[model samples]
Target: MSDEGRRTHGFRRRTPLGAARERLLEQVTPHGRTERVRLRDADERILATDAVAERPVPHYRRAAMDGYAVRAEDTFGASDRSPAQLRVGETVGPETATRVHTGSELPEGADAVVMVEETETRGESLTVFDAVAGGENVAPVGEDVEAGEALYEAGHRLRPSDLGLLKSVGNEAVEVYERPRASVVPTGEELVETDPEPGEVIETNGQTVAQYVERWGGEATYRDIVTDDEAALRAAVERDLDHDVVVTTGGSSVGERDLVPEVVDDLGEVLVHGVALKPGHPVALGVVEGTPVLMLPGYPVACIVNAVQFLRPTLREVGHLPHTDPPTIEAELTRKVVSDPGTRTFARVQVDRDGETVTATPTRASGSGVLSSVALADGWVVVPDRREGLDAGDVVAVEDWEWSG
Candidate 1:
């Protein structure tokens, strides 16, 4: 029932995923520094303050189409059989019509626009062929948005259309939260840069974790690979304590070479040593020099799962990202997958959408060390700790890999 037992037995008594997440979130405080950025450069940045419109969009009443501006009554009783002729004038009046093009300013006293196709111009007079109601085919002032309205509220993540909308409302710049800085350190004696011998493994989890950190709205600093030496690994993590958060992949298990947990404990405090999640049970949550430190498993899939389950949420919390669930779709399982009842499992599956019915098939390579399993998967389906497994034809919500978080 202790943390030590949980680590050795695949989370038989491991902390629940939700409890672990809550503990980490409780310790995270958003990087609340506000900095003004150009509207064009504000995409994907979380807003630190509300953006109020200085002026109404469009700012003027204009014609929505090419037509002749006139009073609604002036076009009354006009049809293909019975046409009404009105004198062309410089200004709009009951007895006068003024020629206007699309987006042109409407003349004074003009309340409607009759399409140019509906009128025939002869000399200084226009013969109307149809009748238009008041305010018809004309755009009123503030039709899109009114002045002094809030375009975006604090904590809102700016999207591409948000940029255009802010520009439409005359916002040239905006205040956004400063992105949190994350330091990623990869440790293992067998880790190599590029060329790997028979016993050596290519070090890529650092890059993977860094990319995930960046995608979750934090700035990532990928440190060089560290060997299994305790002093070297400890020094590398200690040097990065100045960053907002520290993440280390490998050296997290209970093996003799595993030193991250010890380093974190010696430097500060270890909050959590293991979790009840398959392929991610070896994750370590701790603090080093007042900064949050997360230790992930060395296996590629385990690294990915731990990063998503813990690191992503931590980054989002500290970076002030919007609290929104990752995009998901409901799909029926193509086949049954057995899972340990003691641990929650996140199995990668490929989803096939055929009309309304969606089917999810498990990836061929499901091992924790297989990196291709994640690459080939479209999303993941979670089996809760209380549930034995999912049955074939059972509906499950699949978290999209690209849109989740």
Candidate 2:
């Protein structure tokens, strides 16, 4: 079989990066299972149901500042020229005023507050030098949040502020989506566990890919490495079919020894192979026995790119988590980057943010096998397929890598 034939299961066609991503995401079926947990334990978990407030915040009107509550009309037109003097006590009315501290309920007839700085208090009488409008310096009932209000929407991930909000709304427990379970399989004959000498390559992508899976809201399980045998690779994939998703590293390219695409074809259907993406073009997407299987290239940088570009989204969608873009910043390139016009390139760059200027310099290396290149990078800049390359000093948006912590 031709190289292209083997890669695409005899179809000999390469899918565009955007189209490939969409295709793989379409195959993901979100898990509907959820569980209840205490609000304290809900941080970083996706809400399975909307959280509603049981009672209005600040159910009763209270003072908002350290001032005396008084009827606004009584203090009207009262200034330094001729201050208005009134008696101080509860049940304030015309010619009468009350002294209520911050957060204290106002007297029944009082409708506003006179700051202490604007009032001179005597034993039983107070003189107001300034006027205040009704409801001034007061927190009305439900001013912060109303009763039955939706505090958080479904699929919202709980952050630190979210936990505080939930507690304020009287939610002791919350319903959140159960973390989806995933398995990672590393395969290749020339790979070793560790301490690889000379010709042997260490099988390190599995752990890194598994970490990504866990970071994206999945429970990841790293499987034992398999040798370069079609039957063994197929068996490993079959054993992991019960998991919500399976990710296999290495042997995804179109070579005589590359058996991932062939195994996927025999077990299920290869949805796509050979994405139009630099450093990670050998990615493959398929489904085996109703489980999504994502194939990643053996190279380290390729594994990182494919995992961030494809696997992260797939796992998030399947796990019922919100797909939110990471924070990004605009930076000027300090050096030129060359890329094929037909392929979308992701170049790692180290960003130096100084005051108003953000300088992005390409990492020391750009090879797919260089893991340190990405490790030293702060973010990635993409050169779209329509552009041949990016020139130095070009202003571009740098996307933050998926956060693992």
Stretches of model 1 off by over 4 angstroms after superposition: 1-13, 71-85, 91-94, 108-120, 127-138, 352-358
Highest TM-score model number: 1
Q: TM-scores of all models?
A: 0.87, 0.84
lDDT of 1 at 320: 86
In model 1, the worst 10-residue window by lDDT is 1-10
Q: Positional deviation of 257 in candidate 1, in angstroms?
A: 0.9
- In candidate 2, list every pair of residues with a backbone clash: none
Steric clash count of candidate 1:
0
Evaluated against the true structure, the overall lDDT of model 2 is: 0.87
Error of 2 at 349 (Å): 3.0
lDDT of each: 0.88, 0.87
Off by over 4 Å in 2: 1-11, 69-98, 107-112, 128-136, 326-328, 332-335, 352-359, 403-405
- Among the numbered candidates, top lDDT falls to 1
